[model samples]
Target: MPTPIQRVSERIAFAARTAFDRLPPEMVVSAFGVQYGHLSTAEGGDLFVTRLGWPMLDRLLPSQWYADGWYASHGSQLKGSTGNVYRVASRPAGGKSLDLVVKFSRMAQEVPLEVSTGFPDNVPPEVIANARFNSPMEEFGLVMELRGGGAAPELPRMLTQKPLAIYVPPETYQLWELGRSRSRFENHGHMLSRDQEHATKAIELDIRRMYVLVYGWIKGLDAEDAAEDAGLDAADLERLTVEVIAEMHERGFRVLDNKPKHFIVRPLRRGGGLLHREGALVYGLVDYELLQRTTEHQEAFWSRRRQIYRDLFRRRDEPSPASSATHLRPGRVFGVDYLYAETPDGGRVWTVGRNPGLFDYFLASRWHRTPRTKLSPRNEVYATRTRDGIDIVYRKSNVGVRPRADPFERRGRQIREHGYNSPFETVAIAEALRRKGIAATVPLAITRTGHHSGTARFLHDARRFRVHEPFRTPGAPAEPILIPDFDYYTLWASFGCSGQEAGATVDLETARARELLDDAEFKALAGQSRADLVALGIAGVPIANHEFLLSTDAAGRLERDARGKTRVALAMDALTAFEYQVLKEDRYQDLLRRISGQLGTLGVQKLDFSGNDVLVLLGLDGEFLAGPDGEISGTLCSFELMRGFEGLIGEPPEGVPGI
Candidate 1:
């Protein structure tokens, strides 16, 4: 009765399943990312299994889901409000036998009335209202955490089912068939976002897809059944339940629908004695869909973690006993590449460039917490030499801030037009300009500060929330996933530093203020730089005097012209060793006129272009290093708002042709 295509498909599926079985399982899981393999089943299903689950993975194949010897769980507690659960026992020929507890995932479904109404009367109203079942992935992740996935002395290890795998069958069903609530599904994004700690956006549940969770079965009976078999008094069983719940609470976990039925207990071989440890009954906890941390515990945990981060920041140069290098991985955002990792305190760092060595240098604890000189009084920007002796400038990002209520201010107006660029955008723009032969500061990294921002309530800016809405960790907690509630920090290589010496680099504004260059000289250089950038098709550049950094030689002495004028050096000719600098005085009038004319011909405007954004370089003996067409050397040092305009200008030749 099968069509030819169906028959061929079945054969192909069988071959794929056979090949999957032949592949060696990867046993060791690294601390960084998920290490797993996708498995295709003969019954047209998919399985994602961890290294720990790899041993018994074959038993999880969809074809054997309902095979002989698997029976529905009929305990009193399993009879109501939970997903379809079954106990499966398999003894394969010449292989290790497996006992699995297979349950269909009930993600996105409302808590059954019976379950919701069972919450203790003392429980918070909000907790009861928001209770729902966990997705398969979430349940597994939580179970791993409970089982000491990242064990610490303070956290007590709790016995629980070993999460083997998550499987999805080939068949699909309508939402109604799965008893999914449309209202809950539609409104789930924010809640899911709140629950997850992912890098981006809120998680969404696929109502049409059925997800199943498979766990290694614990050979035990529920508390009630076990107590009946053990002939324990009611008071003893009640005391056991209370003690177990308290221990789990101390370990930062809670089950909203807590009941004795959820706990599994096993008896000893000899006299049918119950398992005990340290004068207390030992039991395994199960059914974790409603698992969560208590509020007081979560707060204390984060507070302690914040202190640890501060300590780490102070001693960054010293070898860390808990090096997080293993967790670092290659990541790219926009056009820039980064070696990124989540910090021990729950913060994240995205170190720019491809080198893994640069990752630790930009960690917030390495620089932000160090003693530093304020670089900008108006902003929380500072210049600090890291414990490793690398100079860097770090500034708090204002992506989600509104500076003033006075709508007339430049910052306010700018915020209205375009939300301040996120740290990722800032670094991406800087990197792009560098690739295009434009001189700009080196962006070191971006940090998501682990501390709660708490600044969103005072400001009216919704930009950060909207911008980061797409990057959310699924099934984290609602508090940690509120991206807008956390502050962001961006790091940049100090532009003024040359090697270990500081103050070797000075911006045009400081130079002018220090009388290194007179008023007319400064204005002329700034104007020419703006004209050159506009000619190159970049507009809206912030080129004010402070934005232009001028470099000094190793001894921190400025290069000078024959006439005793401080010279700003640009670049050196490889063949001639002659350096180029912007023309001095009215000598640049002709070149400036030409560049301005080119800007006009290209029909572009200097929106935010100013003298502060320019840089100049002088040749040997302060002589001019002119191009073939007598072009002057002018470069950009700032690109916060720089944008590439359309048309007119051709790409610069290989060497930029002396521009």
Candidate 2:
């Protein structure tokens, strides 16, 4: 037990951290290793404060609410129907006393029959099914959010008691006594694992433990009590209640059991009339255990927030006050600097770069749920334009899975030699190739959902686990953290979707499917692509037709010479280009042979190759420009599977299929 002097000293220390009038950012602390991983540092332990409220640390300390503090309360107000709630006033030496409502948190308990049945008829089934009780932290968090994070002053603030703090005593109780399940506790642990890297603090509840929520009391009477004292009839009370409910819903919040008793109304003079703000009844909302955002509002909020995040990301390097508007922080994983944050759905995101502002632009909520066009049938890949109008293609990573192979197949032989590369490896290889004068699709970000992979769990792939050991946790000894309990998405900039290039690119597979080329022409184009890779020193993996995207004119037409032969060329950049005119069979074969002979001298191997792997540039008139080489050139788009000299293999003409 803390002595009186020690308690006072602790409160003073806590209050010292806050500026005199300005509120500090909401923060979380861990207790007994029941960590709020996303929001807290190792130094702060087991506490969560709402950012929407002014944190009166001295008034919020446990010493002001329990044991000696309880005995010192001036008096207790009438108890509410829910039980375990008490309103009291506590005074510190030489300081004005604070009126507070302290309640035992009912988190993890089943919703009572009356409370569950009290929801509006139109309430969503999903919301009703999950409407039990909010953990002390959740209740305060929702309150803060409703208060508009205290950062935005243009919006009208919600009228509610300021959430002070959640205090979890350093004590435990039996499960039966607490009516909480250990399974729920473990579930929180899983959520912690997914978002532990987030820097914002949130409260996480534990099983078999007591949580106390402290709130600043509003000086008013419930609508029912005030109306009666003011000689208003039941009809007036009902009207007031309905108005409050509607107001809350309009603000994107709703209470499951919205009753007149939950609305606190101040009396104007000796219970004669109720107070009003600008001709509207002023009411303070209370009881937020079942508070939630309406489905429509929730969707719109996320969309708007995602847009703001992307805007921040674009100017991340520039100085601005808006940088702190969204939830983002610096994170490092697998030797790559990423802007990291948690999605509203509890998933994790890591945008590959230094700009934290760019983190929200990659959130799955922004694109994954939007209408997307399937880019491939064999792989789980799709292209979608984000709410911000940026086109991106995202694919699930097969990092920890082995490839299916048969010894007789050419592609199988290559698959046996190298496995799929992780998203980190993909971006790293892309950057490396770009530095070596290869143009590739821009690798943007990666997202890991909270759900586990159903198939990968049954398979054995030790190599990926071993290679990614260091990424299990930053600064920790290599542990096998690359387990299969997650589905990772690798996001990339869509080829030919940047400024002035939108829809001006066509992959070879699409071209062939669309009959833009005859059988002989398609075959020659595929062969030319193979020869191009050979000259560039890409070996081992068989390049696929769909992986190569060629630039086209604004009208999506290929450049043709006077003889009606398609003029195919690779544009390296502003200063370089490679032109390859359609040639006769014998001439094309000679060029292919010459390029194939240079494989050993160049010595580069790609673990995987597809149309998505390379990009061709074009001049303003859609014609291929001539580079220094004046032959063929393109950018490497997919490189997660590319390898360096150490892992290079010689070109084998016999085993590679479709080449």
Candidate 3:
């Protein structure tokens, strides 16, 4: 008779098979774990089903499609490190045939554990933690990314199912106990006693639970088998292996194990032939457990590609000086490394990082070909789909322009008086604000139009734009280093929302505020909340409708927090507001009075009240309430005009007090 553990495993498997049969044909599932009595399986460890495999599961496992069907016949075991694999064959509903591979990650075996001690020879603690946490999910995620065409078409498709089914047996508890003990032993080598061999054997047998993975059977022979059958020499096999590895690197992946068995070679149409008609044999890789993108590969390939594109753009824009050697590379500025490139129009593109997805999307020719919406005479904006199918907005920076009769001309004057930050400075400020927990628009890249006068014009005068800063090397006294001016264009990101789009975001001034309050209604609010409004002004920030954005769900209703208040984040253009003024001077003075007593409490000395600088977080009932800190909770988005009180010491220079 079968043991109790075996009976329980069989029962769980039967329940899963029954559930799979009832699933609708259109429903697709991915990345689900199984839960049993006092036990839970990890993602990709239990079961995974992909979109393509959803309609075909029943056809793929006819015998196991129903409760009355015979149990699946397990075939010869295949080799694997973390799991055991077996060939599974079954007949379809109408006498069709199927061939599949089923992988079983049995819990009986002790998983290898890595414990870091901060020693030089050991792996870093973070790396070990990441490996432990990501091992189960990495393979599925990588395979999905590859299948989505994020990389080359040289990888296998994943047919994973969702909500992995759990299997609980009498031995499940024992398996857990053994696995934990073995992990402890492996992590702490000194814990092993003199009878290490007996302990190892005891740990091995206690493994019980198992995860199942199913994939469509590929019709091919292993590289070794193909080589032997085709009578290929060792040199030929080695050459093929090297070529495969090179292709993988080009596609942004590195295989941790490069064994010949990991590769499969399909036979040609002509029975005996192994090569394709084009004289090149195509092969696919299997076993994605150790597949990952390395930092070295990213820098060497993607980053280098970005540099090439940048150089090409620069070269097309203007001719390089015969005497000056131009090497396309990343330049360090303000503690940030920017990837430098020149555009075809003699413009310059300085990306914020070595390899940002934004650069790859915006710099592409397709984006340039897309029609642009002119928001202003000086600001041209474009919306296009990135490679990942995300909507992103790109607007030209309006630096170096002087506009007359502008409604906010006073604010413009203040900005000019304080010194206009270059595109680089803008990006730096955006990053700094984000670090301080202030919501703001994410800055992707900076593009500067070509010097109208030509590169030679700046050759002699470039030093004038360069700022001298103190720099000391070794024991020498501080010296000034000249930093040249590389004119920049506007920054870009997914607009009207945070960098990562979760849901729809609406402009506070035009869309949301109007929907929530009528002109007269807002006027009433101005009267009722005058004190609170003034308090906001005194907080040393401006309030603007366009500077803030409210997040909403798909239904267009505002998202709420636990306390039933509307949620908001700073918009990308929020920082562009540099002047301070409320719509009325009386309101501004009232705000100044409200915050005067707490002037030292506020991080900055001066307060700027414009119609657009901050967000007044609102409750569902439309009532304003103090945030957690007993002050009106406002989302301060801009730091452009905010300045420190010279008299204060040992305090942060920005943000609302107690925020």
Candidate 4:
């Protein structure tokens, strides 16, 4: 450790440097097989590398190393957090000149939990062929294809089809400032234990730093609002915000995170300026890993409400209700209908949401909605019970953020045992899965519960009941739909744990699933599950000696092809992080074994889990109706399998099955 005076000097120097850059490099943090050094370079002064693991560096750098000068190689070191962030640099193999920025993250894991060194067996070939909440999607079996240097207009089109962009968030910025403040406090407080002044001073400085932008943002927008009337103007803003939200939601995308860091206020034109005051300013949102096809509106509303209260009210015990969406209905804004979609090539389309009106509306609604709270300061009330039958209220903070007084106390964050959604863990797992011959498509989207409220069981119920095959359908084939009495595949995925803390295969007990099930939607779905399963032929029988840990809840989403056939599209959404780890470990494999054993007992010697590893699997019921064509199971080949599949068939793979 540096001496007291030296430390103080270092702190001062660090602060001066960081005043300009996003990351300040004055300290060294060592972990894994590497070490990182932070300092300012002449290029873009104030920028710093917060952390860099050696093995990671060695893998990233073009050469062994160089001095404080810049180079010309393209490289980066990712912290592997939920932020798909990377401290990037471009250096020539033997030249000068470098460019650096903290790149964003679309996916992250806790390093060790899910290690995907390579592919598994032939996995699915689709974008989300076979996915797992804990394991990587078995679609990345294909090598990553990078696209750059293309004309600007094509960028958006290509991006949506097959592009991944990362971003930094305001929280990271806040955390860094928090650390700086804490350091300042500790330095002064070390000698003057009762020096509240020192701590307050540091905190005040940080608060000012963090909020200057918020205040300016609000003030600037308020000025804009002054030009319009509340009735029509407010309605217009609300409609714009909701419309933009609807477009993004329908496309199935989520922004970088909760803040302005990953986004920008840019001109609508290609030649935009910095002031954001000129023509066609819009929210140029960045980052993709956080994107999701399905996110509840309430979560987003609550998040915005929390920010409004924290920033606008400054924790002054103000009961502001306007900070959040007054609307209760879930629709377009809640789901990004305008931002993402699947392409003909099965890639992705992500640029649909980057428009001017969208950003303007986003800022307007977020800045102005500061409603008054109903409760008294230091008072508490019972949490809400939703119509979906979910009573999963865990947070205590009634502030816009938690809607309660404190979240830690009620202990609602059950699955959050490690990394705030580990991006590192997933990276490794995805890599490993690829090595194992699986085609794992990574997440462009992530889900958030009310506490992460998922209607998983309901989705299951809906799907299972949609095509329930009662025992005696007059002309049904010998093996119809999913036979409940003898054999059935528990098509599901895992959620919660991380690669760093738990292996990808950690198992979550029912207690935890119970916690996840606390979600209103799942609870209501569970209410209908028993009757549906009974109708489907599994109410009393032992198919594969297995009782569904996830008894299907009926919300009826399973879709059969429009063709006059039994062919259908099934999405198996199962497993929380805990369950994924369990499967990654002994139990999941064991569960597979138990199921297989039960199948043997049923005199069925054949089985097919032969594809890539996944949180869930999609299969067409071919046992009777042509028993899933080759495209069903054969349609999926993990990265490992995809490559090898071609060699085996001496030809490229096929496409979607049936209608």
Predicted structure 4: lDDT: 0.25
Please give each candidate's TM-score.
Answer: 0.48, 0.56, 0.36, 0.22
Report the C-alpha lDDT of model 2 over 1-659, residue by residue, as the tens digit.
Answer: 99665764565565446643343434334332232211121223244444322345445555555656582365574545474777877656238667888777777666773544433335666666667676565566567777772223355676888776666676788988887766665654554434333334434456756877777888999877777677779777767766776667666778877877788888887538888788877778888877777764554454345345444544544532454545565555434566665554557777776665566667775677666877556678787767555557888887766766675887677765566766666665564444444445667888888666655545545565555554543322323335565788889876654321334555565455445666688888778766765565434644445445555575657656688655443332221222223233453343334333332244556554433344445432344343477744444555445444322212212322211
User: What 10-residue stretch in candidate 3 is worst by lDDT?
Assistant: 32-41
* Top candidate, metric TM-score: 2
Best lDDT among the predictions, by candidate number: 2
RMSD of every candidate to native, in Å, equals: 19.8, 14.1, 27.1, 26.5
Q: Rank the candidates by lDDT, best first.
A: 2, 1, 3, 4
Tens digit per residue, CA lDDT, model 4, 264-315 = 3322234323233345234433333333333333343333332232232222
Candidate lDDT values, in order: 0.57, 0.58, 0.42, 0.25
- Candidate 1 wrongly placed segments (more than 4 Å): 1-36, 66-81, 91-93, 113-122, 149-153, 186-205, 304-308, 315-659
Model 1 per-residue lDDT tens digits across residues 1-659: 98765764564454345443454433222211233445555466656675557655555555444333243422112453366876766545236557777788777787863444434323577787788776666667667766762223355577898887777776789988988877766555444433333323222346677877777887788888877668777787767766776777666677877777788898776687798888767788888888776764454344334334333433333432345455556555554566667775668777665555456657665666566877444567776756454556787877677544346876446535654556766676666555654445667778897778666466646764564454333223322222676788888765533221234555555455445667898887677656654554435745444444465555545666587555443232221121112244355544445433444544532333444334334432344445466665444433343333223222322322211
lDDT of 2 at 563: 81
Cα displacement (Å) at residue 553, model 1: 40
| TM-score (C-alpha) between model 2 and the true structure | 0.56
Arranged by TM-score, best first = 2, 1, 3, 4
lDDT of 3 by residue, 1-659 (tens): 98665764554454345444454322222221111111112211222344445445444333342113222344455654345555555455556645666554332243354433422222335544444212232344555554443344445332222211222222254545434445533332321121122111111112344334455666687677787667677787777767766666556665554556767787665556475535667576766655666544443333333334433333332323343323233554444456565444445566666553334444533244343444333235555433223334565433333222234677555544443333444455555555555444555666554444233432233321332133211122322222333344444444453243334554343332325545664344334343444443424344444334556777656766797544544432211212222223554343334443333353542234433434343322323334465654333333334444322222212331311
